[model samples]
Target: MKGHTIGELRIGQSASFTKTISEHDVYTFAGVTGDLNPAHIDEVYAKGTQFRGRIAHGMLSAGLISAVIGMQLPGPGTIYVGQELSFRAPVRIGDTITATVTVEQLDPGRNRAVLRTVCTDQDGTCVVDGTTRIMPPKE
Candidate 1:
């Protein structure tokens, strides 16, 4: 599960992880993070909103991107330094989400990697798009 070291990374290196948003997942995320927004937790309340239904927390979907950075691309020991994200669409329960991270730049002297991060629903619609900076593990 070791991640690529700074020197080993390259532009275009990529990785991905996929997950289905489930009722249990949404509930647990809400409970754990204490983000009790009705749009994410209350179906009845959500129906009146613009989304017209419950949507998973944007961060929950972002966490999928984190999963890829921590466990797949740069893998274990990666230190997430910064991220900038845009939530493009609602993620409803039962939607399968795929998170992908691709290396866009590598700065070996500073031991950093800049990656293009994205999460797409089953329909291939981008739900989240962002850039992440990380310090890859030093071997």
Candidate 2:
């Protein structure tokens, strides 16, 4: 696995990944996680609720942040030990979401890093936000 060691990290360093939310993505996520909330899968039911239409699961958008941390910032060998996530807005199928991770603090003594993570829709609205602690790869 390829990734930056904690020694190589600097506060404010960042990376991101973007993916369009698709029906398949949502359905597959629901199946994989058993998070088949009617808000996400039942359009007829959703239309009667606050969202007025089917909305994707919040964690599905947050998973995009994992993509950034695992494949971009700390890259392949990073190990997440903690995270805090806030779901702010609904993510609908067809929305293009961008998940970004920025190095917020580095703890060389403990081989850990604090990263600020967020997910925004194409409209630039933040849909998810949080901070995560990880043990970055040593090599």
Candidate 3:
């Protein structure tokens, strides 16, 4: 998580971070986002939804992007400019999701970077795909 610097960034360079989604985590996220969709909070109700069981909120999985940019690649004090995302698959509780980001562009003068982001499950199933714009501190 250390030894990485802004200068190390390059187009196509990538990094990843993993998180295990738990039922508690799902409940907590639901509390925070007020997204108590039965598909995400109630097993029986979820069983009737298209997902067939409780699922984690898309944003909860997307939050992994923050772990990637703030703790791994551009690490600490990175400013988020914007992001674009598309949800591909439902993430269930207990799923270990890995979020990855690759530098798609870098602006040296501004210390900003454009990254392609992807979140996948242990089986390599994509849960979310997105792009982010960030500003990391200059060395």
Residue-pair clashes per candidate: 0, 0, 0
Question: How would the candidate models be sorted by TM-score, starting from the highest?
Answer: 1, 2, 3
Q: Tens digit of lDDT per residue, candidate 3, span 1-139?
A: 3534568877888899999999999999889889998888888898988888888999999999888888877877677899999999999989999999999998888778899999999999999999999988656
lDDT of each: 0.96, 0.94, 0.88
TM-score of each: 0.98, 0.98, 0.91
Ranked by lDDT, the better of candidates 1 and 2 is 1
lDDT of 2 by residue, 1-139 (tens): 6999998889999999999999999999999999888999999999999889999999889899999989889998999999999999999999999999999999899999999999999999999999999999986
Best by TM-score: 1
Task: Report the poorest 10 consecutive residues by lDDT, candidate 3.
Answer: 1-10
Residue pairs that clash (backbone atoms under 3 angstroms), model 3:
none
Query: Where is model 1 poorest over a 10-residue stretch in terms of lDDT?
Result: 1-10
TM-score of 3: 0.91
Error of 2 at 31 (Å): 0.6
Selected candidate, larger lDDT, 2 vs 3: 2
